[model samples]
Structure formats: structure tokens, C-alpha cells
Target: MSKTIQMPALSPTMEEGTLAKWLVKEGDTVSSGDLLAEIETDKATMEFEAVDEGVVAKILVAEGSEGVKVGTVIAIIAEEGEDVAAAAAGGGAPAPKADPIPAKSEAEAPAAKADVIPAKAPPAAADNRVKASPLARRLAEAKGVDLSAVAGSGPNGRVVKADLEGAAPAAKPATPATAAPAPAASASTPAPVAAAAQDFGIPHEVIKLSGMRKTIARRLTESKQQVPHIYLTVDVQLDKLLKLRSELNAGLASRNVKLSVNDLLIKALGVALIQVPECNVQFAGDQMLAFKRADISVAVSIPGGLITPIVTGADSMGVAAISTAMKDLAARAKDGKLAPQEYQGGTASLSNMGMFGIKQFEAVINPPQGMIMAIGAGDRRPYVVDDSLQIATVMSATGSFDHRAIDGADGARLMKAFKELIENPIGMLA
Candidate 1:
């Protein structure tokens, strides 16, 4: 009997997905655990594996079909010599029908087969291409200059009309016999022709949005529209903390552990969250959740994207352990190999742009997690200490929280406790 292969939930929060690509085709043999397609979910692009082995009898959905809800039958698998027609004809236990997401036509398919060669532009007007701006074309036609003779300053090397009218008139030699030469145009005067518009090379490159990126967009958009968020900002004094970090790094340098301010901040935040559990909370379904353990997500940015890998049970780990775990996670993050557990289940998050020299920033709270802390660059600035004006190391940490899970007062209290832990590094260790 043929079996219906429905789109499975690739991630915990995946409700709908995009069929990124199909590895197998109709009439192709498949196995119980063979990869069927790559599905782009809100979280990541993950492989969709077959659960029952058979020949691919029918394909109902094409690649790049987005918003396919979970359990939608996307394909069928049948035994050898099995009737594919019978399978597709809605016979034998009739598979549930999906509302049918419109599929892309073969001509519009994004994937190119290995044997396919892309068509090259004809070589004319070959060596030079024609690309003219509306104004330039109008001016060129009005001025009676041939656009083809003009070189293109536009993108993809297209000839713009400006290229024609702006062409420098050939410098003529002075002949004494002529009536007083019309006043020679001064070089300093601006030309009547408009300046060339900057060609930002193809308005945009079509990037296939990954599952996580899509999910991030949807979730953030929903958060911004539905969930009310309130932000609280606090300045942290880093003088004593900086000295402590230097001492710790010097002591642990032999152990191949270099402690950064972020590592310390993570440790401190974990401890502070333990003290103020109200901030370590989540609003899901119709219930409110307060977590005791702080699973802090540390945001890491890579070349093509950004991922936040969680340091689970951060409240239970020391600075050295946090540093070591972060090093491994960060390496994997850059290489794009972090396992699901490594990036999920965070009760709170920390996003630091200090090393990049950003003075201040506001962070969006990662959904479900009630709050996220945005850490800014540390700098030496004037401060009032003991009735005297003096320079001191200071950094700003802005906390963004969901009002549904935490109030302004709760946010302030949490930030206050967090500042103390960071200001006195020993307290975090304790």
C-alpha cells in the first residue's frame, strides 16, 4: 500500500515551512531513512527524511512553496510495480488534501540541474551594453548625440544617456582668423547635464530566506505588533570589574582560558537572574512560567547570518566553564554546526556589541524569553565619585522586557541587581 508523506515539524516552534528543495523525484526509489527534501522552517533549513521506504510515486508540492502547514501530505511512496496512478488518483484511504500552495513553474524554478548551462548575453551593442536613465535618454535624444558612442557609467556596464550628452566636446585648437571666440566656458562651472546616478549593482540579490530567518522575522513582527514591550536602561561602572578580569585572565592564561568582559557579564547576569526570578520568565499559551535555572543565550554573528547558542544552566557554571563552553559553541556557530540543544531553551539572552565599539543600542527581546540585555562598549568617562569629578570606566546595559511577563519596576530591580554583580566580580563568583 502507498503511504502519504506529510511535512513534519522540523523544529519545536515550526507551524509552517517552505519546501526548499526535493532531493528525490517521481519514480525514484527511496528508503525508510533517506532524505526526501530540505524544508525551510522559521528556525533553520533542515533535511526532511523519509520514514517509510518505497518509490516516490507522486510529488504534490514543488520546491519553494512556502507556508506549508505541518502534516500536509507533500508526496507519496509506493512499492515496486505499485500503481502510481492509483496512488495519485485519490484512491485507497484517500490522503488528506492540503489547500494546495501554488507551486513555482519549472521555468521559474530556482535550482539549476548540473547539465544546464546559463544563457550568456549576446556579444553586441556586444562589447558595450545599453542602460539609460529616463532623464539621460531624454537629454541624449534632445541633444542629438548617439548613445551607442557613449560609454556606460551605469550598472552591468549599460550606456546611460548622460554618458552621451556629458561626453567632453573634442578640444579644438585656437585659430586666429575667427570672430571673437564665444566666451570660453569656465571649467569651475557645473555642467548642465545631470551627474550619473550611482549604480548600486542589481537592486538586490535574491537570497533564499532560510527557515530561521523567516521564523525570526515572523516572531519579531508578531512580538512588535502584539506584545507590548518596555525598556529599562542602566549604566554599569566597570573599574573594579575590569581589574578583576585582568587578574583572572593573567591567572588563567596558562590554562588556555582568556576571560572577557562578556564572559564575566554572562556569569554575573546568570547570578542576578537567580536573585530576581521574575525576569527569568516566559509567557506561553495562556500560562506564565517562571524558571529558576538561567539558560542564557549568547548571540554570535557569522558571515551569512546570526545565531544565539545557549549556555544551558548558566547559573550553575563557573566563569571558566562558561568560557570553555562558549569557545566551543562559538567555533561551531561560525562553522554552522551547533546542535539544536546548543541554540535553544534559553530563559534569557545577552547580546554584546561592545567589542565592535558600539556606544549604545536597544535590543529586541527574543520571544518566550521575557527579556534580553544589550551590552554596549566600555569607555573611560567623567563621573562623580566621593564629591569629586574623575574619569572612570563605564558601560551601559539596556534591558528590553515584555510587559506581559515583567513590569517596569521588575525590570529596574533586575537591572540593579545585575549591575551589582557585574561591578563586584567576586559576588558573581560567589
Candidate 2:
């Protein structure tokens, strides 16, 4: 029998992606675990692999195709001893349904599918079976509409989003007037207004937005509009920390490990979060989550946009280990080869622009994460040492906190702990 291969969902948030390239062509033989193509997800470009051994009979989708939906057949393969021409002419046989990919963390999971409330009315289907697309299901649940009542307009009578338009939700019983009044609904962020297209007649080329760019634009806009931000700044002396880094690098020279200032800062932020647990939290609608361990997400600038690759358990890792891990993560991130788990979940974030000579700037908070620590360049400046003015190496650090979850006092305490750790330079080691 022939087998059909569909486009796989590389990440939990991926709905559609660009088929960047195909490694195998028609009539090529492939085995299990062989690289098949490169898929460009919103976060990264990941390589897809083959699971069955066969000969590539036909390519259903061409390379560089954009907006290819998940579960769409992309290619066909003929089994061993099967006629390639026949398989190609007949298309490919249907493959067995595969299990959905499991999410690595709660934050990465889709809340719409997990928390949907069922409608009160029974489904209209006589056989008690309903066929709908994932998007249609989500919309139906949100609107309290029964899926069986709606007629599908998609392939093979599959319900789609268009079918739910103008559909009313099932009615519920009204509360008694004598009972206590219900709580007011929370305020929602206003939807963005679309701008009218205009051309100034300038001679320029038009470039389409990539998936990564679109995601970045939407996420950052939502973060700024929804999250209430509180900014706190502190100047830390880096002379002692710099000296310690030199000594540690010399000791680890034989191990080929070199520690950057950013590595030490990552450790500091992780330890500080542990010390002041109040700062490590996420604010859900009705509850707050307090984490026991600290996972630091380090921001790396890629070709199209920025991605944060997480350094898990940064508090307990040694400086040398942190350095090694960061080097590998950054290298892979730039090449667009990081897995979803490597960049998905984190207790907090750390963004360093010291290399770009940025003195100080406030960073936008990544949602679900309470705070982000911004590091600035360390340069020579006038400082007060023991009530006397002296020149010292100083850097300005800013912490952007979500006021909904963390209070100003707790944010200050975290900043104090981070400053102490950096100044002493030995407390982190102990």
C-alpha cells in the first residue's frame, strides 16, 4: 500500500506554516528517521523527518508554499515492491491517524481546547457523531453553539469557522432576582483598528511579513496593551564581578570554558528570584501561580525576529555550565534549529543589550512571565565609595514587573538581592 505524508505541527501554537524546502524529490528512496523537509514555524525553522521507508512517488505541495495547514497531505510514498507510477497516478493511500503532540508545559498548551464549556442543548445529529475542524470546534464552544446543528461547508462535510457565523448561543436559565447579583466582567483590551492602505508613490519593493514577524507584532502589541507594567532601575558596580569572571576563566582554561558577564548575570537573576519567591509568579484570572524553581529565558536576535531560548534550572548550575549551555543555545537559535521546549516555558526572562552599547532601556514583559531583567553596558563612571567619590565600573539595570502579580516592594527586594549578588561576586558561588 502507498502512504501519504501530511504537514506536522512543530509547535503547540502553530496553525499553519511555510514549506521552506524539500530534501527529497520524486523517485527518491527514503528510510525512517531521514530528513524530509524544513518547515518554518512562527518561532523557528525545524527539520521534519520520515517515519516509514518508501520511495517518494509524488510531491503534492510545492516548495515555498505559504500557509500550509496542519494535516494537509504534502507528499506520497510507495511501499517496497509497489509500482511507483501506479502510486503516483492514483495519489497515495491514507495513512493511520497519528496521536497529537503533547505540550511540554501548561503555558504552551492551548487553553481554548482544554477549558471549553459544553453547550446545554444536545447535538442535532441523529447518530450522535459530529465532524468539525479544530478551529470550528473552538469557535463553537466559545459561542455555546451545538456543532451537530450546523452544516459543514468544507471538504467531506467538515464544519468550518464560516458555518458558525450569526449563530446564537444556547439559552440558559436566568438567576432569581432575590439572589445576590453576579460579579462584573473583567475589562478586555480593545481590538486594534486596521489602517487604510496608502501609497506615497515612492519607488520601493514590497515584502510580505513572515510568520515569525507576524507573531512578534501581535504578541508585543498585546503585551503593551493588556499588561500593567511597573519599572524599577538600579545602578550596580561591576568591578568585583569583572575580576571574579577573569579568575574563574583562568581556572577553567583547561576545560575550554569561558564565562561572559551575561552568564554571571543570568545566575544572579535566577538566584535572586529564588531568594525572593514573591517575584516569581504568574497571574491567572482567578489565581496566581508560584514557581519553586527558576528557569531563565535568554533573548537572542534571529534573522527575522527575536526568540528567547530558556536556560532551565539556572540557579543551581555553575557559571561554567551556564556559559557552555548559553553558547550552544545561542548558536542553534541563530541557525533556526531550536526545539519548542528549548524556548517555550520560563519563570522569568533576562534580556541583555550591553553588547550593542545600550545604556539603559525598559523591556516589554513577556506575558505569563511576571518580570524581565534588562542589563545595560558596564562602563567607567563616578561612584561614591565609603562616602568618597571614586571612578568605578557601573551598569544600570532595569526590572519590568507586571503589577497585577508582583508588588513594588517585592520587586525592589529582588533588585536588592541581585545587586548584592553581583557586588559580592562570591555569594553566587557559595
Candidate 3:
């Protein structure tokens, strides 16, 4: 028997991916758990592993093929002693199975009446059932191209991948004044119109967007449009925290553990979320999810885009442990080797631009997560210490909360707790 290997879903939100490379070619023998190919999903480039032992009979999709839909057959594996040529010839798309209809019980069956005529579906409903290839449909969705408006060039007027190339998205219909206004654009919203480029004879290079960059653009646009963001900023003296970090690093010098200012702040945000649980929540339709433990997503900028690698149970982790974990996560994130689970879910997020000398800025809230804490650079400033003029190292921290799930007062309280934790660095350790 031969096994048909279809494209695997690399992540929960992966609809399609690029077959970056093939490790095994036709006629190569592979066993279970052997590396098959490198797939570039929206999040990362992951290695696909084989599950069954067999010889690679054929490769249907070529390397560097983009927009390969999930469950689309990519290759075939012929079992031991099977004719590879025969398997390759017969191993195209699998036959579509007809859905089995269940037999209705006599007591539950509705009475058939000659007078009851079946209602005709509207023209628009019929038009929505446009014939299109899976790749064409996926490309149309990403590019916001309307299949009904596109002129197909394939057999029987079926929409093909080439039909969507350079096709403009359909314009939205105008809404009537009497109708209620639609909500802000969300993840399900169609992609906005792309900005046209004009070089004006200037020498410039046009770089194609990678899968990661496309996902980031779509997600951040949706976040800003749909998520109601409420930013609360507070200035806290970082002198104490800085001093504690120095001492802690000195104590851990023998163990080769060093703590960065951001590590202590991550601990601070995690503990603050624990202290003020109201701020640590997710907004779902009709209900809100209150988290018991804080899983903090730390933002790391890579070549293509930014990624947040989560540090689960950050509240209970020590600064040394947080530093170690963060270092590992950040390195892996930059290498694009993190698993989907490592960057997907979090109770909240933390983004620090202090290394770049950023004074203060508000961060967009990652969807479903309640809030994100943005950290600014710490600098020496004149301040009143015990009612007297003094110099202190202070940093401005801003918390961007989802107004739908968290109240302004709760957000303020979380900021207050974060300030206290940073000021009293010993409490975080305790």
C-alpha cells in the first residue's frame, strides 16, 4: 500500500503555507519521524516530519511553492516492495467521498405534501458558490479579491491561481443612513486596499512580503481597528530596582546568571497582574475570561517582523530564571525556531524599547489578551524624595488595556501595583 502525504497544519491559525524545501526526494527511503520538508507558516518556518516508513514515490508540489492549502496532497510514499512508478502515477488527488445521509425514523419523518414547494435560493447565494481552486480561494482571501468579480482563465471558467494575480479587492457597498453602523474591522474583516507604490524614477527595490510579515500586518491592523485600547502611563523611580538588579547579578555571578532591567520588569508585571487580577483577563463575546496565573508574552523583533514568545507562570519565576528563559526564548524567536504554542496564547504582553532609547510609547493590545505593558528607557531626572528635591532614575511605563474587558480604574490599579513592585524590588523576590 502507498500512503498519500498531505500538507499538515503547522499552527492553529494556519490556513496555507509555503513549502520552503524538501529534505527527501523521489526514490529516497524514509522512516517514521524522519524530516520530510521545511514548511513556512504565518508564524515560523517549521520542519515537517514523516509519520510512516516508505519510499518517496513522487513529489506533487515543488519546493518554494506558496499558498499550499492544508490537506492538499504534496507527496506520496510507497510501501516496501510496492512499484514506485505505479504508485506515483495513481497517487494524485484522492477521490472525494460522498457524504452519507442518515435514514430518518418513521415517527420523526415529516409528512410530504404536494402543495409544499421548495423555496428557490436567491441569485446572490448561488453566485457565492463560485467554482475556484483551493489555492485560488486562499489567495483571493489574502488579497481581498472577490471571486465573483474575477474573470477565470481555467477550464469551464473555473477560477485559478493566476486569476487573482494583481486583481483589486472588491469595493464595499455603501450603508444607508438609517441602518446601524458596523463595528470596527476585526480579524474576519477583509484585507484593506494595498497602498500603491510610486518611485518617481528613484532607484528602489520592491521586496515581497514573507508569510510572517503578512500575518503581522493583518493582525496589527485588526488589533488597532477592532480592539478598544485605553492607555495609562505612569512614571516610576527605577533607582531601587536598578540597585537590586546589580546586587542580584553579583550574587548570581558564580552561577553565570545575569538579570536585565527588562527581566525584573517582566517579573513586576506578572506579579502585578496576580495582585490585581481584574486587569489580567481576556474579552470573549458574551463573557470575559479571568486568568489565575500570568503568562507574559515578551515582544522580540526579528528580521521580517515582531514575535512574542510567552513565559508561562511568570509570576512565580525568579528573576534569574526569567532572565534565562527570556534569553532562550528571544534567541529562538530570532532564529524562527519557536513552536506555535510558545508564541500563541498569553494572559498579557510586555514590550520594551528601552534599549533603543525610547522614552515612552503605547503598545497595541494583542487580540483576546487583555493588556500589554510598554516599558520606556530609564534616565536620571530631578524628583522630590521625602518632600525634598533629589535626583533619581525613573522610567515611564504605559499599560494598554482592552476597554471592553478592563475598566479604567482597574487599569490604574494595575499600573499602581506595577509601580509599587518596581519601587520596592524586594517584594517581587518575596
Candidate 4:
């Protein structure tokens, strides 16, 4: 029986994928769980595996093919020894393509050869001391330098411009002077000619935009141009929160775990979201849909793209659980091996550039999610606390809300609750 191998959805946001590489050629043997090809999604390059055993009959999608929608037939598998191409053309069953098999040892591949030069050439004396044109020989004789001593600086190592100039002066070698260094040669020579001023100019390379870059550009452009965004700013004192994180980390470190201030903030946000469920609402067309679970998405940067992997049921997880889950997700994200369930179903997002020293920034809301938080670096600043001027560690968190789901007041109220939670982090443990 012939079977079609359609493109699979590698990620929740992937409507289509690019066939980056095909591991199997036509007529190869395939088995269930064998890797068939590599597909580049919006976030990463994922491996496509064969689910059944068969011979490769035909390849509908070639390597480097793009814009293929999910579930679109890309290849066909045919019966053993069957001609897949002829079968497919005749509207008959196609043959299966072989999946890539991994090599078990380095000996299976040929070793690279080493480059070496043989040393059996004639010695300098017998090799005819020097080869030079008659005119050049005359010039060297006139300059009183041995031709053998001057390496040819011209084409094919032939002596040319300043072979004579580079030769030492004919005077006998002088004795070294033993004295204090005289005023370092007062005359400064012009900086060695500025690398000849690169007439052709420095070369540059042109790279085509990847799928993720394209999506980011399009969405951000639409967001800035169409979405009416309003800004709200509030500073929360973070001295106590910092102390709490340090103490908890000191104790946590004994258990082979470490936590960052961002982790604590994520936990705080999760707690606040439960109390203010309005912030957990999503804009579904004309309706506002609220979610019961607080799935918090944390933005992680992979080599070629950015991905937001979620912490499911974050509202119910403790600070340590949230921290551990986030670390696991981040590690897998960097490795490009995260399953679809790891990245999908986030009700809200948190983007912290504080570790990178960004003071503050406004972020675009991820679609369907009513809000996204942008966090900045915490620094010491002066503020009035009960009519007394004091220095305190403060940080700012800004939320971008979807007006269709959350009103201005609703977003503000959620942010206000978050500010209080982070400011009084001890209350978050409750």
C-alpha cells in the first residue's frame, strides 16, 4: 500500500514549514521511528520521522522547498521493489522513502589526508646558488650585496624592488651602545600608510531573512501601526525581594538549585494573576475568554530564533517548581528538542531584559494572550517613604494589553496588584 507523508505541525504557531534537508533518497529502506527529513519551523529545525516501514516511492517535496502547509503531502511510500515514480504517475500506490540511519562509529567514514612536502630536493650549493636576469645581477653587483643573501621579492620569488634596499648596509657591524634610552626618536614616522586605503572597500555579506525574522518583523509592524497602545509606568521598591531571593538561593544552593530575581518575579506574577483573573482573559474574536490556569510563557533566545516555552499551571506551582521547570524548558529550547506541548498554551508572557542591563522597555502582546510583561533592571533610586527621603532598590514592570480583551482600568489594576506582590514578596508565599 502507498502512503503519503505530509508536512507535520512542528510547533503550535507553525502553519507551514520549510523542508531544510531530506535524509532519505528514493528507493531507500524506511522503518517506523526513522528520521525522514529536517523541517525548519518558525522557531527551530525539527526532525521528521517515519511512522511506518516501506520503500521510498517518490519525493513530492525537494530539499530546501518552502511555504509547505501542514498536512500537505510531501512524499509517498511504495511496496518493496516497486517503482514509486511510475506508480505515482499512474495514480497507483507510491513507494516509501528510506529514513536516515545514524552511523555507529567514526571508522565507517574515510579519514582526512594530511598535507606534507617531500625534503629530497637538491642542496643550496648544488642547486645553482641563484637565478636572476642579467640586468638584475648587474644591479645587485653594483649595490655590493650577494645575490644569494637577498630573497627574491618578485614574482616566483625573483629578486625585484629593494632586494638591494632590504639588504644590510655594507658597513661592518657596530657594537651595541650601553646608555640610557635617548628621547625616543622624536620624529614619528607616518602611521604605516593606512593599509593602502582599501580601494575596493570592505566586503559585506547578504543573508536572506529566516522565517522567525520575517514573522517578528510583520507582527511588530502591524502591532505598532494598528494597535492603539497606551503607556503606564510604576516603580516598585525591590530591596526586600532581593534579600529574599538571596536568602532563598543561599539555602536552595545546598540542594543543587539556584534561583534568580526573575524567577521570583514570575512566581509573584502567577500568584497575582490568580487573584486578578481578569488579567488572564484572552481576546477571542468578539469575546473575552478567561483561563483557569496561569500558563506563564518565558521568552528564551535560541541560536537562530526566539521561542516562548510555557510553565503550565504556574499559578499552582511554587517558586522552586517554577524555577526548575523554566530551567528545563530553557535548556531544551536551546537544544531545539522541545515538544509542541512545552511551548503551547500560555495565558500570559514575561520578558525580562534586566540581566542585559536594559532600564525599561515596552513589549508587544502575544496574540490571544491579553497581556505581556516587560521587566527592566533594578537599581538604587531615591524615593519618599512616609515623608522621609530614602534610597531603595527599585524596578519597573510594564504590561502591554489587548484592548479587545482587557480594558485600560483592568490592565492597570492587574499591574497594581503585581506591583504590590513584588514589593511585598513575603505575601507571595501565602
True-structure RMSD, every candidate: 12.3, 12.1, 11.3, 17.3
Which regions of candidate 4 fall more than 4 Å away from where they truly are? 11-13, 81-204
Give the winner by TM-score: 3 or 4.
3
Ranking by TM-score: 3, 2, 4, 1
State each model's CA lDDT, in order. Answer: 0.74, 0.81, 0.81, 0.70
Which stretches in model 1 have alpha-carbon errors above 4 Å?
Answer: 25-28, 80-99, 102-214, 250-256, 283-287, 302-306, 330-345, 384-389
Over 1-430, each residue of candidate 3 has an lDDT whose tens digit, in order, gives 7899988998888777888899999999999999999998877889999999999998777687666677777888999998999888774436311111111100111111244332232122243466555445556655557777776553345555656668998765566766568665434323422222221334434345777887788788999999999999999999999889999999999999999999999999999999999998999989999999999999999988899999999999988999999999999998889999999999999999989999999999988799999999999999887899999998999999999999999999999999999999999899
- How does residue 420 of candidate 4 score in lDDT? 91
Pick the winner on TM-score between candidates 2 and 4: 2
Question: How high is each candidate's TM-score?
Answer: 0.67, 0.75, 0.78, 0.70
Shift of residue 126 alpha carbon in model 3, Å = 15
Worst 10 residues of 4 by lDDT: 104-113
Query: Tens-digit lDDT track for model 2 on 314-401?
Result: 9999999999999999999999989999999899999999999999999999887999999999999999977999999999999999
Question: Which residue pairs does candidate 2 place in steric collision?
Answer: none
Clashes of each: 7, 0, 0, 11
TM-score between candidate 3 and the true structure: 0.78
